[model samples]
Target: MKTGVMLSCLGIGVLGLTACGGAASSALDSYKPATVNTPEDAKRWAKNASAPNVYLSSTAVLGITGLNGQGQAEDTTCPKRNQDGNTLWLEGDCTDSEGRKWVGKARRESEAAGSDTGRFVYEGFGYEGTDTCGGKEIAGKWIFEGVVDVTGTEEEIHFDIDVRTDFTGPDEDADCAVSDESMAWDYTGTVVEDGSSKNTWSGSGRVGSSKIGVATVETKDEVIDMSVCDSEAISGTTTLTGGSDTVVITYDGATDCESSSTVQWSLNGEAKGELTGVSCASAGSAPAWALLAWPAVMLLWRRRSRDVRGGRGRRRI
Candidate 1:
């Protein structure tokens, strides 16, 4: 999970390196325009963005809703909660086993079912005594717009999450060379009593000057059983569109017996990387895509600034 969050941040912060290479274009070109034309279109978008890892993603939100240290059992935290009418509000400070402190806030409808439905409003920020979450100072401020919709009955739970976040970047003096990222995620999923479900997710965002996107697009789907999420196999696949090019990746998650996952990536049906270690765990605040894009994003970051006809400096998205 740390890997996924860190790696995803790589895409988020590193994408800012506009001159990173044509790689960003190819890896994220599949996504469409930023605006939604209709409610149905928005619904479809929300559904897809919530896929890939429904249980984990939902749990991730749940952890944030309660500031439970991102659901890491080993972490210690103190939190405050309040209920008013149909809504519940939460705020808290938590310290991970490693002593990193996470502070976050979340508000949501108290009910989990029926037409009224459940939705969450969340904001989270983390910092060490200085910057501790990632070697790149991964712990910054994460703010969310849009509400996460909760559907289904007790026997089954479906989540429709469409989140747009404007991430606060670090100061000019920072250990991590990563840039600020503005991202939007639309995804949906349903988990049954058996802990099995189907999910489709997609996202597009800007990391500085670079643009990035990822989605299942029109691929054959898979039925995932979260309860049995022991890795060791190709868990899923998605097309990553960056800049102007696309890359296909087959993801293999961390087996119950292992600490890391691997990915097989290709472009035009040719292998891009074999046995690349990726963050496949579901225990950190980092998004999974970040882990998958780590190696490639770092390469893009190393490439440098975009070709600006006029001027260049950090501009907040």
Candidate 2:
């Protein structure tokens, strides 16, 4: 009888251990990390960074990405200037890192669609200090000021953006800012589906805010699927600020994630009005710890099960 009890106890212990292991695995799956759907979702970040609907941050990437203008994808860096109650003035030069560069100024209104509005301005520069086509000087700055409906969720964010661009210059000087160009967009985002700590974002928008007599404006919102979270550094993929009008830009500069913890940027999907990118990282260890506790619980359960089985077996024997 004693031998039978011992054997029963051993079997129960083995089963209990296995159960514990299973429990641990389950706990690990339930773990959740500190997540950010959009590292600096242009709208969300601007709201959080700006004041009470006065001036707001100038989204260089957002501005260019959502633009239905002509040219390849490139970076346009701007300098921070002064900010009045609801108006911000920024003056900077742009060097097309990967594409071409043009001089321009953009303004973002702090009000929603049906409320007050804002303005944006831009002036295209001559390539070699002179206009090429028809020897016509492309002068004057294109200006845009309008209202927008910006709405989105934690996992899925969307934007319905519309704006008007104009060009005006000396008609006799062969340079002018032409009005009648408009760009519109509809965007969507999905969180944490593409990678461990990343989200995929893409959207479509009209081109033109294009020139009337000039080339057609490519009205497509470029895909922006990028990992935009940075925990260790002050300046990385994501940046922080106090009010809406004050703008400070930074870079994530993380291309080779293996060498650096910083997340890199990439492009995905077709260019028919939208683009996408991915951001992923090593998951946190909290889940691993949670899973560790299950093994102990299962061991105890097995001991109890074995005791009950032994008692019944002995009584029958």
Best by TM-score: 1
Q: What TM-score does model 2 achieve against the real structure?
A: 0.25
Segments of candidate 2 deviating more than 4 angstroms? 1-80, 84-137, 149-155, 168-317
Expressed as tens digits, the lDDT of each residue in 192-255 for candidate 2 is 1222433332222121112111111111111222343332111222222222222222223233
What TM-score would every model get versus the actual structure? 0.48, 0.25
Lowest lDDT sum, 10 consecutive residues, model 1, at 308-317
> Residue 299 in model 1: shift from native, Å?
16
**lDDT (0-100) at residue 301 of candidate 2?**
10
Q: All candidates' lDDT scores?
A: 0.35, 0.22
lDDT per residue as tens, model 1, 1-317: 13112212211111111122222233234344432222322222222232333223322323322232222223324335676777767565755444434466667674632223466665552222223233444444433344455655544555554444443433323344445654443444443333233222222222211233343331223323334443322355544433344455565442332334444556555665644233332221222111121111212222222221111111111
Against the true structure, candidate 1 reaches a TM-score of 0.48
